[model samples]
Target chain A: MSPAQHEPDEDPGAPASSHAVSAPGAPSAARPKVPRRVAWRRLSTISRARLSRGTLLAALLTLVLGLALVAQVRSTQTADLENLRETDLIALLDDVTDRADRLEDEVRSLEQDRSRLESGGGDAAAAQAAQSRLESYQILAGTVPVSGPGVSVRVSDPEGEVTTTMMIDLVQELRDAGAEAIQIGPARVVATTWIGVDEGRLTVDGQPVAAPYSVVAIGDGHTLAGALAIPGGFNDSVRRVGGEVQVTEGEELVIDAVHEPPTLEHARPVPPSEGR
Target chain B: MIPVLGLVVGVVLGLMLQPEVPGWLEPYLPIAVIAALDAVFGGVRASLEGIFNDRVFVISILSNVLVAGLIVFLGNQLGVGAQLSTGVVVVLGLRIFSNVAAIRRHLLGA
Candidate 1:
């Protein structure tokens, strides 16, 4: 539109028109010549106007596209489960079920042994020794069921902001409150229980535990509740991270779930020192 | 020259930041990138031919990205996302190849 811009526009057209005139003699030029000239003229006219804004817009968009591309590649690379084939998913499910069946069989045998120990005839001293041993084994192995006054904590992470670290802290807080036994859903927390994230869900011993996580702790109900209710405690932490936690005292809280004892691959138990 | 500098900066920022794309947008990203690539190649070809229109280049880039993403999204809703994505890629790939060929012919005179 400006007189200054029109001067350069006409300058480029002079050579193009001269070339068009000289190219008419060629046999192959006739078919494509007319359209090519029109396109050439139109492009020069448009490129001359508002050059800076257009180039900047294109650059910004390309930057965004580049960022999205790199981000997507990195995300897909890190997310292993998303790449699983149908057969792989099925195999994974089968493996989990098999493990569950084996654990169930172990639980059945442990229960039978517990019943026999209680009913078998024995002298009072021998019976008392056996009872003590059973209690210790039950506590360590997380096999025997426990029922006592305690607190139940229900945690819900609607936004998935709660990490595995937060869950571990919650469990630790319960233990610090003198919790003797704890059950998270069907999985019992033992000395060796591992908490981790699997497929975007919290997992205890490789078993996925969904949100609205129920935590039952066998301890003094008031003490357990107070620990979680303390300032900057587990409940406060969950709330800070866009999650919810509810704690309630109960007269009788039962945790019957058992944990699978880790099979030892190394290091046998050393005999107690004789001098002691 | 400016566009090339922009591209280099874009690539560097992409590499250095490594931001995480949300889960819902993952499926559409690669297709949109391919479409943008086609537009860039076409722009290069136009510039070589002395017919590069800035407005046309920007409009084409925007529309190409949106349309490509839309096609894939519709395909996903219809349960044919993978097939349609292949179709979009093949078409855009051909466009890119032809545009590159034009640029090569203009610059190298081959």
Candidate 2:
């Protein structure tokens, strides 16, 4: 376009307005004054109006440009987790595995608890079952003194000839008759009780016993008495050893002797939710 | 004055819209943006040089973005996306730098 409106030194900022003379910075101070009407006329020119229309269209395209830019920035920040060292990746994998393990454990425990709760028939039934089991353990373990309908045996050994073997046979005979508890002399008889002779003394679990030994068994009284009187049984064995055996059936025989239950050293309960 | 005003309005509009780019378009967006930036700088430099043409400026920006995106897409199909993207970025970056330098020179008269 011929550079028709040439000036000696046009201000850079004055180009967009297309009126270098109207520059407000250095030129305004140097010249002191310029016609505001002429400046306005130059601004309202037809060529400038045409350029303005084209600029509007160009700026519309920039809208897409701006949007794309922001989206790219956002995507970069939030995703693209692929870039990492191997150790970091492994650590992330480990974290995920640990979380999965914890969730699996929780799932297993919840499933077991749900099944137990459903089958237990309710709070009352569960409590009753627990109480029954506790009583059984107490009696079988000889941790508590037990009284029930059973039979009592009196051995009158005037010759002091009732050996440990005879006493053991009597206890075995009582157990076979469904006897839940037994007391021989001053000692309580349990699964772990030992009848042995120590220093030539008839000892029941390390305690010496004298003549006239009384054995109390808590079970069906007739059943225990019949077992003691069976042919070639506890009565025959004691009689053969020159000891007189007297068996008496009673409804309320008491085995007041109690023993300490041994503590477990190595055994443990298995986990209920093993497969899960 | 109007051109710069239009650009500012476009930026404001883009911010307000914040539209989501589709999956297919994601890979090429960065390339396209860089190409558009190159065109914008060229246009500004040309305007400072008093050789600014409305049709040329518009066509340059539109064609630059499209051609850059197309190149990246073709490179992806040929399994050279990474290399091609780097090459395209380097060329566009050089052009943008030269244009900006020219713009700076024009503005400062240095």
Candidate 3:
């Protein structure tokens, strides 16, 4: 379109002159062979332009392919994260299962030991030895059921104002007062149970507590009551925190309960002669 | 022209030799091949730029080494270090193909 571009078309060396006919209606002499080489060179130039354009298209395709690969890598990373979480869950479940199996084996062994002792001739010496062994096992199990006359402290709110921390603190006080086998509501208290707020209610073992938490202990009832009555005891703390704690005693407080603890799966059975 | 043809033939041979070998030697082979290709490409770029200097060659070599090392490190950290080291192989494959094509077109120009 520019004047400078038109000047090239008019140039004698230009490729356009290879096809140029001089006058519109007059017969012209045949052209020499030199312009034919120019035409071939021009054709080569056109082919080079087409090849360059094709290369550009290839470059564009390569870019698109790289982007698709990046998307695939991101999706794979997400899947890997999910697999890690599943691996953790499986490991935890395996641990719990292993513990349960150990407990089952211990129960089986104890039942067998007891049966052996009862079936064996009731010699005084053997009975004494077996009783001693049973006592030792009970101590090791942390579940030696103790029954005696002691005080039972019941803390509750008829209007429901008791907090979980208050309940935990109260349990701690009872524990300090030498209460064995403490249970709040239906959930049997253990060493590792984490007491926390669940929903709007105070809960242990996933069970919600209604009012009046009954806490029973097997010890000297008078001594236990005195211990709670002392300053900084559960009663004092409860009163200071505006919570209720009441203590009473009876001739006998039986804690007829059994805690089936977790079992171990992979441990070989302990030889009876090997003592810890 | 013979150098270009030799480079092409060497790359083809290397690609053919890859899978038949064990994995422990695999990493070194690809890295060596890539380094060699990078040197060849640097030579061509330097000739085009018409200013040959050791500095450009050194920088190119350093960059190639760093990039290849980083890719391998990332692959290892992502837990597919051994199995999917083919990522490095694929990149090398693309580079070799493009380099061979470029050399061929230049030698057989319009």
DockQ top scorer: 2
> Where is model 3 chain B poorest over a 10-residue stretch in terms of lDDT?
B45-54
Q: What is the DockQ of each candidate?
A: 0.12, 0.19, 0.03
Where in model 3 is the C-alpha error above 4 Å?
A1-123, A132-146, A158-161, A265-276, B1-110
lDDT of 3 by residue, B5-102 (tens): 33444444444443233344334334534544544453342222222233344444445555665666666678665544465665554544433443
Clashing pairs in 1: none
What is the C-alpha lDDT profile of model 1 across A112-229, one tens digit per residue?
Answer: 9988887675558877898999897887679878889999999988998888899899889999999989999789999889899898999998889988899999999999999999
Highest TM-score: which candidate?
Answer: 2
A20 in model 3: Cα distance from truth in Å? 99
lDDT of 3 by residue, A142-249 (tens): 355556687778885755667777778766766776766565766666665557667777787667776677777666778778878888866776776566888988
- Show where candidate 1 strays beyond 4 Å: A1-51, A83-276
What range of 10 consecutive residues in model 1 chain A has the weakest lDDT sum? Answer: A13-22
Question: Under CAPRI classification, how is model 3 graded?
Answer: incorrect
Query: After superposing candidate 2, which stretches have Cα over 4 Å from the reference?
Result: A1-131, A158-165, A192-203, A206-208, A236-243, A260-276, B1-62, B72-86, B96-110
Q: Compute the lDDT for candidate 3.
A: 0.53
Model 1, C-alpha of A216: deviation from truth (Å): 69
